[model samples]
Target: MTSTKTMLTLAVATAAIVAAAPAAAQVSGIATAAPDSAILSAKAFGAANTQIATTYKAQLDQATAKQTALTTQIRTILDTNKDGQISQEEYQASQVATNPLSGRVKAAETAGQPAIDQLRAPAVKAQAYAIEQVALKYDAALQAVVRAKNVNIVLSPNAIQYAPPTVDITKDVIAELDRQTPSVPIAAPANWQPSQDTVTLLQQYRQAVYMQEMRRAQGAQAGPAPAAGTTPPATAPRAPTGR
Candidate 1:
């Protein structure tokens, strides 16, 4: 089951939207904050999202249609008997040489994947460009939020088993990020590339978005959906600490 922290964190923290840096502050009391959430919530992220969405609307639209068709095609193979769900036997069979349908199923998957990827590439790139921009400003935002909130000990939503609502300063952190960068450039040069950290952050952001979707859909995730290009991070920024 998803905890309130994870749910709440994931709700706003899509794309880690990534996480903030390890907090450096005086310690006085304990508080919980999801820096990942804050990073996603920044105004710049929103602005970038709008810009990217506008720029890549056609690609996104194509992707949406392609994804739906792919889902149907894949579902037919996985749910061979139309049982409404894919059984382990069916899934395993689809991958092995034993089933005659295996070759066809594999073929379908291989053929459709590239087409879908190509269609979504432009939008995906734009999304990444925007998210990386937000990540660049995350450290400063974390510090500002921690100090302004007078939080001494800050923990990730993932770390806290339980905490009072008041201690969850994810919103304040986001507000700080907004103040830091109201907007960022959405376009990336052909030579442009994100750092490994930004790449990881983008992944986390996607995972969080997936989790959030599962919660919303009751355990069913759709596709490579966008969540403010979520601040995905393999190593999210740490929250500030108070003495």
Candidate 2:
């Protein structure tokens, strides 16, 4: 299992790649497709394919209910005076009462977080697995789209300096993915770790996307060069060098 930090890094890198291209370029390219260049919205594609909403709806609802109940109980405890609103002093007092050793208010308040996490771990793991499966499906779908369109390069919409609607194969890729993988099993093994191949591919994808985005951003920030034949503005001759 990849650590949460690694997952966050991958997500950030991917997002950066998608955001690399200048908006002006994309707008200008809307009329024509650059040879072999294609843009896609990975975020949208992932959202469209995620099955957690349907597969874990019941569990999510239960979790939400539990959270609400816990919140009410905590609030009741903090409002020691039975007042409708809890004052800062009352809250502090409750915290001190709960854990005198450590004066950490949040720690005392969220003591049940560990228990909540334990309860949801299975569902969380299952949802993550489903998303991973969808990602794999997305890769295959993207490949098929690339072959069909005879495209040599695929870029996230964020990375494109310019791209025409004609070159955006996101819809096509989504359609293909839906056709090939309409649903994914949300059940995850008790202990799941992605295969080495999957890890390598995921890492490569994150790095590629991040680098492309960074390159495009740098280019965009590099303002246009002085127009050809334009006269350079003359600076007052540097004050005659002191004798």
lDDT tens digits by residue: candidate 1, 14-42: 31322343333212355666655666778
List the candidate 2 regions with Cα displacement exceeding 4 Å: 1-62, 73-105, 194-243
lDDT computed for candidate 2: 0.47
Give a tens-digit lDDT track for model 2, residues 1-243: 333234345544544544566755433322212111211233432443255545555655665556545555555545557765656566445435455422333444356444544444454455445445666556566667777777654544544455556777767766776777766666756557654433444334434554565466448754222211111111100011111
TM-score of structure candidate 2: 0.47
Compared with the true structure, the alpha-carbon lDDT of candidate 1 equals: 0.60
Question: Worst ten-residue run, lDDT, model 2?
Answer: 234-243
* Candidate 2 steric clashes: 7
